[model samples]
Target: MPQIKSLDELRNLRQQVERDISTRRHTGTTIIVGMGTCGIAAGARDTMHAILEELRKREIDANVTTVGCIGMCAKEPLVDVEQAGQPRVTYGNVTPDMVPRMIEEHLVKGQVVEEWVVGRLQSS
Candidate 1:
């Protein structure tokens, strides 16, 4: 954290924090990528980069995160999408080429790509 040198700076910092909090509250879409050893070996890093690029190109506000192994070694390069009021959907064998269509159908059109889905978990 940087030192707040002036009142205006403090006010600006507060406003920035408030905006970040508001964004988190409103944008309920979260994209979780598996970055475990098996996942990386299966090209998860490329998938993650593709995801971020697609999100940026579409100007979508999403919370992209990562996780370790989920015990599904066969299903490496797993990507999970969780949105408000919807079940978390996990897609297996995700590659960079599939990112655009996934984001388009899932995030933009509000439809899950059922064909690529490997798991689904309903939120409580």
Candidate 2:
């Protein structure tokens, strides 16, 4: 391994790591869980864990992320989902119980669960 003793060398290593991560970034599907204080208090971490466990059990390829709040603490545990060529959909008041249904409707069937969606958007 190349020596990384200097601060400049460390910066270069950091840049290289960032570049590698950017190259491997997921292009098809994603689920972003808001992880702000309110979200965590409302059990977003549990919701996120449930979602990830389901993905693992089902052997699905989905990129999950913890994101900053979208200024809707009233709707804590918000989740945003996006797929290739699909409009990004946001869900509010997420809970562990909702993860399975989300995976079924959004990931598998390509249909949004309007009841859980943040707004009155079509299920397509």
Candidate 3:
């Protein structure tokens, strides 16, 4: 690590750390998968893996993350997408098979895959 020589340097380091945390906190497009025990049993791991693979293949820049149960235990494998200035769309019972289309249409084309959506949370 480099030694901090001035207050400006400290400020710069702080800004960089904030940016890094923000990137991990959320991206322009965020893909959040439920990874709780129920979600895992419902194949959420496979769903998450598929989403990551598709993002890489398509060259999409988005934050992919996992969260605890979404309160809908029956909808264990739920996936949520939150894009800038858009409502967060939650999809229930997600499967690895639906990942590609979800990414292509929703993430790439800015369209919601209404067929898979269980609910939407409007942006605040």
Candidate 4:
């Protein structure tokens, strides 16, 4: 760390942080939906759409992405949310109707919707 020479430097650093937050909002998050063959057949596409719509409705910007199975093909239509320093929470067998509720209960409220999470078949 450099020595604090003048108040201007501190002000500049704070300004930079504020800018980063705004940028962060635009780059909000990485929301991954499993679209593996089984997942797609099960309805992951709809789940992805629902998630995007919910985020839009809530005015929360996020970078939504899709990927092949996490090897839990039985739990199709799985959704994962990863925020720095927080454990990844994965929702399985999700439906369009459940998106809003999931957002409210999980993303916004900081609560995991256990009923929707895949069975704890694996340890972190």
Indicate the TM-score of model 4: 0.72
* Model 1 pairs whose backbones collide: none
When 1 and 4 are scored with lDDT, the better candidate is: 1
Per-candidate RMSD vs. true structure?
A: 5.0, 6.5, 6.7, 10.9
Best candidate according to TM-score: 1
lDDT of 2: 0.85
Residue-wise lDDT of candidate 3 within 57-116, one digit each (tens)?
Answer: 988778889999868979869999998789999999999999999998998888898988
Q: For residues 1-124, what per-residue lDDT tens digits would candidate 4 score against the true structure? A: 9776987888889987787687786535668899989999999999999999999999976779999977888878888877655677788878889999988887788787888876432324
Ranking by lDDT: 1, 3, 2, 4
**lDDT digits (tens) for residues 1-124 of candidate 2:** 9765777777888887786565446455788999989899999999999999999988877889998777899998999897766778889998999899999888989888988888533336
* Pairs that collide, model 4: none
Instruction: Give the range where candidate 1 is weakest over 10 consecutive residues by summed lDDT.
Output: 19-28
Top candidate, metric lDDT: 1
Error of 3 at 44 (Å): 0.5
User: Candidate 4, after superposition: displacement of residue 75 in Å?
Assistant: 0.7
Candidate 1's displacement at residue 89, Å, is 0.3
Each prediction's Cα lDDT score? 0.92, 0.85, 0.90, 0.81
The TM-score of predicted model 1 comes to: 0.84
Q: Across residues 4-84, which tens digit of lDDT does each residue of candidate 1 receive?
A: 577777788898778688767766799999999999999999999999999899888898999999988898899999998
44, model 1: CA deviation in Å? Answer: 0.5
